[model samples]
Target chain A: MLAKIHITLKKDVLDPQGKVIANSLSNLGFEGIQSVRQGKYIEIMLDGNDKNTATNKLNEMCEKLLANLVIEDYSVEID
Target chain B: MLAKIHITLKKDVLDPQGKVIANSLSNLGFEGIQSVRQGKYIEIMLDGNDKNTATNKLNEMCEKLLANLVIEDYSVEID
Candidate 1:
């Protein structure tokens, strides 16, 4: 199974790196870019065929190491 | 318009950060993990309603500043 995970900052959390990207884009003459928010995308290949098991393991991985629970949220997709 | 971009390293490029994550996951007892690859996900809010225009601008953005064309590949989706 392959698990795709997206770990993103919560709505209330500030993202300085994203802010810098937005500013840089504006300076580059790309107009009307209101905001930019960045996150982490991870793809994990697992040796299992069961989707359920992979999902459970992925969730556990997120909670344990992939995501900072207090400031970020994660979503997982199994294939 | 909202543009979602995924910037990933090419298959040939070595990703040290991902290797570290895989090692950490193994140390944490997650088994049967074949590999872990990490990328960047970015969302941009634009003031235009036209998807075509947004897509064009996004491609330009990616080429000009968003991605390092030498070692990375980028995909842009407009919604």
Candidate 2:
């Protein structure tokens, strides 16, 4: 099984890198781009016995090592 | 409408960042971790009249600005 996780800074947190990218976009005349938030896209392949087990283990992995829950938010898609 | 674009280095391209991440994962005891490839996830909010138009424009944006075709490959998800 493969799980894809996206981790991003919470909205209230400062994102200097995102700001820089947004500015660059505006300069390139991408007028409708109001904002940009950079994030991590991680794909993990698991050897779980089943989907249920894989989901549980991947969630645990996220909380333990993948995401900084205090200042970041994350969501996962399993495939 | 919002379109999410995922851009990643081509399989043949060298990814130092991904190598570093894979090494970190191994050190962290992620036993089955074979490799890691870092990528970009960009969400663009468009004001197009319809989905078809938005996709067309977004494709153009990817080719023109969002992706580096020489070393990167990209896919889009519309929502």
Candidate 3:
């Protein structure tokens, strides 16, 4: 099975890197760009017998390493 | 308008960070994790009259700032 994890910063958090990119785009004349938020997508291949097992494993992965839960939020989809 | 940009490392690229995460997940007893590939998602808010103009602007953003085309591949979806 394969699981796709998406991790993103919380809405209120300041995304300095994304801000820099947005400014650079504006400077390059790509007008009307108002904002940017950068996030992470991770694809993990796993072996699980069922969705419950996969969900449990993925939750552990997200909490321990896949994301920094303090400043980021994550969601996972398994196939 | 909002454009979502996804940037990912090329297939042959070595993702040490993702490997580390994968290993850590295995260590945490999340069984059967065989591999992990990481990527980036960027949301850009722009003002454009139509898809063509938005696409043109987004392409410029990707080339000049949104992504490092040398090591990454990118795609964009607008809404």
RMSD of each: 0.8, 2.3, 1.8
Error of 2 at A22 (Å): 2.9
What digit string (tens of lDDT, one per residue) describes model 1 on residues B1-79?
A: 8889999999999989999999999999999999899999999999978898889999999999999999999999987
Clashing pairs in 3: none
Clash totals in order: 0, 0, 0
Clashing pairs in 2: none
Q: Per-residue CA lDDT of candidate 3, range B9-48, in tens?
A: 9888899988987787778877787888899988888776
Over 4 Å off, model 1: none
For A1-79, candidate 1 gives per-residue lDDT tens digits of 7889999999899999999999999999999999999999998999979999889999999999999999999999987
Question: Higher TM-score: candidate 1 or 3?
Answer: 1
lDDT string for model 3 (A6-62, tens) is: 898999899998898877777777778788888998988887669887888788878
Candidate 2, B6-70: lDDT as tens digits: 88889899889877766776677666655667788877665655888767766776787778999
Which lDDT values do the candidates have, in the order given?
0.94, 0.75, 0.84
- Interface RMSD, Å, model 3: 1.4
DockQ of 2: 0.49
Q: Give me the displacement of residue A79 in model 2, in angstroms.
A: 1.0
Superposed model 2: Cα runs more than 4 Å off: none
Residue A6 of model 1 has an lDDT of: 93
DockQ of 3: 0.78
